[model samples]
Structure formats: structure tokens, C-alpha cells
Target: MATLEELRKQLDTIDDQIVHLYEERMRVCEAVGEYKVQSGKKVYDQTREKAKLADVASKVSGEFNKKGVQELYEQLMSMSRKLQYRQLVQAGALGRLPFIEVDSLEKETARVVFQGTEGAYGQAAMKHYFGENCNCFHVHTFRDAMEAIEDGAADYAVLPIENSSAGSVVEMYDLLEEFENYIVGETIIPITHTLSGLPGAKLTDLKKIYSKGIALMQASHFLDEHADWQKISVVNTAVAAKKVLEENDPTQAAVCSAYAAQVYGLEVLADHINNEKDNYTRFIIVTNQKIFLKKATKISICFELPHESGSLYRILSHFIYNDLNMSRIESRPMEGKSWEYRFFVDFEGNLANPAVKNAIRGLREEARNLKILGNY
Candidate 1:
């Protein structure tokens, strides 16, 4: 064995080399990342990474599987990206958060877009996140918001992901998987459902009611109390309120936000009509670039597992194994498949961590579809 002095010198030599190499590597990676981000290229480059792995493996000394080295390279690459992102952020290359500057976002005026009309929760969320002074637009469908952003019609889209009353929205989860965008921010709003109908209408006279899916689910108890009443499931609660007012359907009522009733000229039979008092819905703000980080509490991601009995379990186990808490998970049928599914998960950590990257790296080996929805 080498003497202690020799060992100490070698250790120092290795440490110095590591530091020097890391600095050198960062000098290049940081520049490239800045350019990639400015050019709107994706942060992670698998092909480039693969080519790097091949090049590095051809030169490394040990007989270990090149996968280990590739992992190391990936970790380094991720670290470099984070470093680069930090640099760009500090340089104001990436837009600021906690109040994005109107000019820096490259818009002459502030613009916000959400699914649904003026009285919808999406509109409330638009106001909540963007403030009342900002210009905002509404779309009839969730896909419309995505399409608008993709087609350069809007700068951002806000969509709901989960509700405290209902466990999870499967369609939204699947929509997240299908869409390509960055989750810029999150807004949690306390939902208060209003029972509104035509003026001078009695509760006993109500034979039908209209509401959005979540509001309907929330007000299910009230519906159950009136078993004889017909329920109408509309695309938006605001639409229901608007219809109730315009049609003046004496027999039909609507359960929606009070704002919807006010906007749609519907009379409120009762305010705060939800079965649960503490109802809240969490919405995700999606955009073309990473936007918010200061107030982020959750991160959403998706993974596709191989068709094996324990593949899903193995992948999920990593969350627990890493001591990372998962707030929610759902399996949706994959597109273009007869019996295949992709898993969408909301976890409680940022993707900027080494631990998170390592977990994703491990997961990527077993997954056919792996995507980081957004850090926020």
C-alpha cells in the first residue's frame, strides 16, 4: 500500500484536477445552455449526451460498465445546466418571476389566457395570478388554450390540475401528457359554489341544474337530496350560469362560482353551496419557458413503463426509496394503444436537485416516455 503522504498528495492532485475540470466544463456548458435557452432549444439533449457517453467510454480506464460513467456524465451535464440556468437567470436572460416584467416577457402589454369564459374558475385564476390590471383572454376548451399557445395566439395558458374535493382530474392529467409546455406557476383558489337560478324561483320548484364536472361532484350531496332533479353536465360552470340566465329555465338551476352568476345575470339561490366548506382547486400556469420558482410547492411529471407486471411498482418505489413524497399519481391509457398506459405524477420537489435527477435517470432506463412537465 502507498504511504500516507503519497495517498494525501494523490488525493489533493485528484481534487484539484476535479475542480479545474469542473470549472472548465462549466465554462462551455454554461455558454451552450444560455444559447439553447435563448434559441428555445430544450434544456436536455439525449442524443448529444449519448454521443458524449460513447466518446467518454472509449477513453476511461476501468472495466466497469459504461452506464456508470454515463450516469456520472448525466449528473455533470445536469449540474452544468443548472449552473447555466442560474447564470442566465442572474443575467436576466430568463424572465424574472414573482412578478414578471411586462417588457422583458417580450410583450408590449401583459396578456393571460385560460380555458372558459369570464365567469369560469380559469378566469378567476387568471386574475389571481396575473392581477386585475393585466389583459386576459378566455378560451372555451382546455385544448384550445394549448392550441392558442402552440399557434402563437397567446403567451400563456392556465389550466386546473387537481381539486381538494375530487381526488384528481384524469382528463387534465392526460392532457398534461399530451401537451408540450412548461408549467410556469401554480395558483390555489378557494372554490365557493353558488346555487343560482331564475328570480323568485323556489328550491322546491327546481327540477334540473347545470354545473361543471368538479362543481357537480362537489354538490353531489345536494343533488342526492333532490333525487328527482335532472342534472346537466356542461363544459363550464359559467356556461351553465349564462344559460340559466339567458334561457330563464324556471325548472333549471346552476351551481357555480358567485362571480359567474354576477357575470351571467343569474340570481343566486344560495351562496357557498358546496358540500365541503374548504374546497380548493390547484391550477397550473403553462408557458413556453420556465417562469416561476420562488413560490413553487409541487412539480408534475410523466413516465411510461415497459409492459411488465412489476415495472410500475419498481418505478414508483424510487419515490419512496428516495424519500420524495408523491402528492398524486394516475394511470391514463396511452395514446395509440389498445391496452397501454402512461403514468402522470405530481411530486413534492424541484427537478433542480441531484437526487431528483438521479431518480429520473434511473427511471428513464425503464421508461419509454419520460418528461419533466415543469419544476413548479
Candidate 2:
């Protein structure tokens, strides 16, 4: 029944009191952080947080209010944990990460490996990252490339991770989880697919078209035009070109890069056959060593979340509270767990930064099986 102005003043007074109490609460949390630092205790205590939420909910009225109070406390507790983490970082109590920091990759003496034949996009990415004249070899499959680095047969391996038009190269993500190899760097190359065949072969003479599965999908517009042409998926585009050249059949053509066609001595019958003109593919450079470049600005990590509401959001809040910018996130099914998934996230931060360490520490405690894939 009070006037609108009187009601607004009452709300303002409550807000001021709430701010004062919030600062007082933070001061108490700081004291707790100091005690934990001296006692070697962890910042995140899941059991304590569960109990605190229950206690707060009991003090509130109605189902909606109970839920609201629980959510509010969850955020307040998360902020408290973050503050403690920052204190630990400042006190040098946060342990060193497993990754070693290096001034530069040993490009001069490092042996590189790539998937498929000589002219695959992986080879182009390798040349661009490691240098054109770097020592390198080819592997038959992506698994083979991963193994080459895992077994120390090669110091590094170049593999395609994603495509602009076709989306993620899913097998690569699975392979990353399956292997111990870590990414050290990345390179993106513009993709320009061409239809090529024997020196004298014409587009009209093509009976079958061959390329990698993703390549065929990317050039769907051009392939759809030649509906009569049978499409075959190979291990790599370069391999397709090699197949066409070795068959000596004018009826068979390949969808590949101009460089690949030239490598296999095939003549281009059609150029730029991809559906998107500005297509590109991102490639990752992986190695067996758990080391990161001193100047690396990006970090890739993967983790499995508990099957609870807001789990992903809670995990991601670490990045927000630490002021880290996440650039990409992708999820893949956990190998044996149906419906549940594992998440891969790419964020902007170097492992050496204090804020980066603080976020990672909080994530390690809250997320299950959190793995730092790389920092590059």
C-alpha cells in the first residue's frame, strides 16, 4: 500500500546491506584461503558445497525459492573458490603443471610425419609449419601418423583436424584421446580441389570420381552435376590421384589439389570443384613430448562431466571467472558410455600465465578426467 517511491527506497537499502555483507563474506573466505594454503588443503570441497546448498535451501520458502537460493549459493561458492585459487597462485602454492615450457620447437633436427602420399594436405601443413625442407615421411592412416610420434619414430606428425565446409575431422579427435601424443602447433591451408585424370582425359570421359570422403562431400555441388559418375572414397585425395594415374584409365578421375595432380602426373580436367570457394582446413602438429612453446597463446583440453544438471556450465564458469576467452568447443561420445559425451575445448591462454593455471586447477578438481591436450 506504500507509494512507489517509498518501495524503491526500501529496495535500495536492502541492496546496500547485501553489498556490505557480501564483502564481509569474501573477507572470511580470504582467511579460509590463507589457512588452506598453510595446511595444504584443496580449495574445492564438493561435500561441503553440497551441505551448504542444502542448508541455504532449507532456510528459503517454496520450491521455486529453494531452487533459487541453491543456485545463488552455488555461484557464491564458485566465486569463493576462485578467490582462493588466486590466493594460492599468488602464494606459489599451486603446483607446476606437467607440461614443460620451451623457447622453440627443434625444427632443424626434428623428423616430421604426415598421413597419405607425398602431396596430401597434411604434407602442405607440415611444410608450412616445420619448413619446406624439413625431414618428413608418410603414413598410411591417421592412426599410423599418431603412432609414428607416440613410438618416437617421428618427432612430430601433421594431421588435419577440421575443415571449414565439412566440419570436424572426427576420427582425429578420437585418435587424440586414444593416443598420448600432444599437439604443439597448428596451420590452416586454403583448399582448392581439382578434377584430374590421365594427360589426355576429358571431363566427358570420366566414369568414376575418387577422393577422400570429406573431399567428396565438400565438392558435392560439382559431383552432383556429374550424377552419372560413380564416387569412390579413398584414404586421401593424393592417394586418389595416385590411383587414377596408375590405372591408366581415362574413365577414372580424381578430386584433389593442383599440387597433388601434378605430383601424380595427372592433368586437371576441372579446377576448384569444391562447393565453397573460400574453403580451408586446419591441421594440427602433434608430438610425444609434454612440452609447450613459451609464446603459445591457445590451449586445448578435454574432460568428461558428471551426469548432472549444469555440469558443463559449471565447468565452463572457470574460464569466465578467470577472464579466459574460449574459442571452440566440441563433444564426442565417450567410447563405452552411451549418450554421455566427452568435451573438447579450445581457449585463449598460455599455460605459463597465472590466470590460466588458476582456471585449470579449478577445472581439474571439478571436472572428471580432465586432460590438457596441448597449449599452442
lDDT of 1 by residue, 1-376 (tens): 9999999999999999999998898889878867865786655565887698789887777758566786677568656655554454455444322223121243337567899887998899878877776777888888888777766778878889888878676777776767777776788999999899888888889998998877898988867888988888998899899888878778889998988888877778878878999999998878765454644556677988767555676577557655679987888887788688888888887555544554564455446778777766
State which candidate has the highest lDDT.
2
Candidate 2's displacement at residue 83, Å, is 0.7
Best by TM-score: 2
Residue 7 error, candidate 2, Å: 2.4
- Candidate 1 stretches with Cα past 4 Å from truth are 1-109, 290-297, 320-322
244-264, model 2: which lDDT tens digit per residue?
988999999999999999888
Model 2 RMSD, rounded to 1 decimal = 1.1
The RMSD (Cα, Å) of candidate 1 is 9.8
**TM-score of each model, in listed order:** 0.68, 0.98
lDDT of each: 0.75, 0.93
Please list all clashing residue pairs in model 1, or write none if there are none.
Answer: none
